[model samples]
Target: MSTPTTVALPTDMELVLKVFPMPKDSNNNGDIFGGWVMAQVDLAGAVLPARYTCGRMATVAVNEFIFKQPVQVGDLLSFYSKVTKIGRTSVQVLVEVFAERRVLGNQYVKVTEATLTYVAIDENGRPRPLPITELQPRRQY
Candidate 1:
């Protein structure tokens, strides 16, 4: 096995989610499943948009998803996110996942990056315009 590359975490994006992958989430190769990571990314991507939607929203599209490194069991994963665009009824976000390797003295390695779009939805589950009041700057995350 090669030495895991260590890098600094992002300072611009908000740290949205932090999770530790367990053995149950691993695959035959002992690495965490890609699908599981994607699920977490989808959840992480919505954090910022939730503030703007201020009511209800649904994931409209996963514009892009890239897995750069394999995640291992016991790795402490930190998901960071930033809003890339905000349309009248949709919000686009960029999410980056970094792992603090458990076996490598908790060194950080960027493992995944994804772009996802979410649409504000009404109680009936139809798309709706974002609330204007929520668009104004509020407390920072």
Candidate 2:
């Protein structure tokens, strides 16, 4: 088996979500299902864009997604995201997921990375212009 790649948690990106996978989230192999991870990623990826959109938005595209390591049950997952592009009505973000392995003394492994695009929407579910034209600096929580 290949060794899992250890990585430092991101300093520049905002931490959007933290979750622990339960046994129910695991597949037959005991690793967390990719679709479950993807769903969480989709939710995490929306966070940064929401700040700029300041309104309802929907994922328009998953530009890229890569799984670098498998997520095991009991691992604490942290998702970090940053806005990469701002269009007239869309915001693109890159999200990275890290798993803190308790079995390895809380070592962090980069498990997944994805790029996604979200479009601001009006009440009618049609695309609308973003509220902000440029990213505003904000304090990290």
Candidate maximizing lDDT: 2
lDDT tens digits by residue: candidate 1, 18-128: 999889999999999999999999999998899889889999999999988899888899999988888999999999999998677878998999999999999999999
Clashing pairs in 2: none
lDDT, candidate 2, equals 0.94
Candidate 1 residue spans exceeding 4 A from truth: 1-4, 133-141
Q: Which regions of candidate 2 deviate over 4 angstroms?
A: none
lDDT by residue for model 2 over 1-141, one digit each (tens)?
359967899998999999998999999999999999999999999998988899999999999999999999999999999999999999999999999998888999999999999999999999999998688887567
Return the TM-score for each candidate structure. 0.91, 0.95
- Scored by lDDT, model 1 comes in at 0.90
